[model samples]
Target: MRADAKKNREQVLAAAGIAISEQGVDVSLRDVSRRAGVGLATLLRHYPTREALLEALLHTSFAELTAKAGELETSSSPEEALVSWLRDCTAWTTQYQGVTELMAAAIEDVESALHASCVALRAAGARLLTRAQAAGAARADIDGTDLFALVAALAWVGDQPSLESRADHLFDVVVSAILTCAPVLGDRRPTEEVSS
Candidate 1:
């Protein structure tokens, strides 16, 4: 790519990140172009579709999360690895508005630009989950698919304004449910003390 073209692509991607973070995956291409100070045609030239733009934006994050899962698998106990990775993954999904839906859809569609990255990320989490189950720490009935769905569910619940306050409590509940041998209540964080 020419230097100018590369610079233009970077600007569009940067703008798209800001737009999507603020307005979600559904944010219009026009809005992103406007924010980038580029013409719509230029944006289209760089990212032909919303999925393409999202793939560019999230692929790095997905790789990092996958790497994190690998690190946790080696460094933490089975149960701790699963719980920490779950928490981190769920927290990540909450960053971009409506991204849970995008990730769910992308993972199921091989033609989607994000399919590969999403699958890799899911596999990383699955490794952690399997480790936990093998150690008799996490529930054996659930598999990686179930775990991904649960993460997406948690992200969706956290996305709602009415449930935002309850998200942490809900996370704890989900974590407890995932564990075959639950942690002592006192060992948990996040003020399980929400007098709600």
Candidate 2:
């Protein structure tokens, strides 16, 4: 891409991020172009579609989250790692008004532009859940799909004005429900003693 084209694309994405935060995934493409101070033709030339734009916007964040899950897996306790990742996922999702809906749909649609990124993200969360389950920190019954769904549900709460205030508390509630027992500090417990 030419320097100017790259610059225009970046501007569009930044403006889209702002517009989406304010108005959501359904925000008008024209509004995004207007905000970016670019012509609609330029924005379309770069992204072509809402999903394409979203795919570009969400790709980096999704990669960071997946990487974070990996880092947490190594640096934190099984329970702590899972909770932290879940919280991060939920909080990040709340930044985009209707992203949870897109994510949920994208994960199921193999042909969708966002499918690959969503699947990778889901796999990352699943790894954390599996690790926690093996350590007797989380319930064995729930799988990665369940974990991803919980994140979407939790994020949806944060998006709603009425429920936004309760989002943090609800997050804790969901975490507790997912975990086999409350988190322990200091030395990790033997899986046998954890007693899910």
Candidate 3:
């Protein structure tokens, strides 16, 4: 790419990131162009579609998540690593309004520009989940796709105005359901009873 073209691309990517973070993933391309001090044509020249822009913006984050999974595999307990990564994924999906839905669609459409990034993100989560399952911390029946759906569901709940306050509780409940050794609710067994 030419120097000016590259510069314009970088500006658009930066502006899009800020706009998406503040206004949401659905922010208009015109607004992103204005923020980048470029024309709509220029923005289009760099990223032909909104999904293209989002893919560019999220490329680094996807790469980092993949790298983090590798690092966490050896650095933390399997369950801890899986939980931490799931939280991170939830935060990432919820960072921009509507992003979780966008990613869900992207992951299913090979033609979408964001598909690769979504796949990478799922692969990273899969690594952590595999480790957890191997350690008997997570349920073996749940796969990476299942975990991704759960994260997206959590993010979608967080996006709702009425349910936002309960997102944390919902997250805990969902995670517990996915864990093989999670304590059941109101299970007043010997473990919960005071032994005489």
As for candidate 3, its clashing pairs are: none
Best by TM-score: 2
lDDT of 1 by residue, 50-131 (tens): 8888899899999999999999989999998898899899999998998999999989999999999999999999999999
Native-referenced Cα lDDT, model 1: 0.90
Candidates 2 and 3: which is better by lDDT?
Answer: 2
Candidate 1's TM-score: 0.92
Off by over 4 Å in 1: 184-196
Model 1: weakest 10-residue lDDT segment is 185-194
The C-alpha lDDT values of all candidates are 0.90, 0.91, 0.85
Q: Roughly what TM-score does model 3 have, to 2 decimal places?
A: 0.86
Ranked candidates (lDDT, high to low): 2, 1, 3
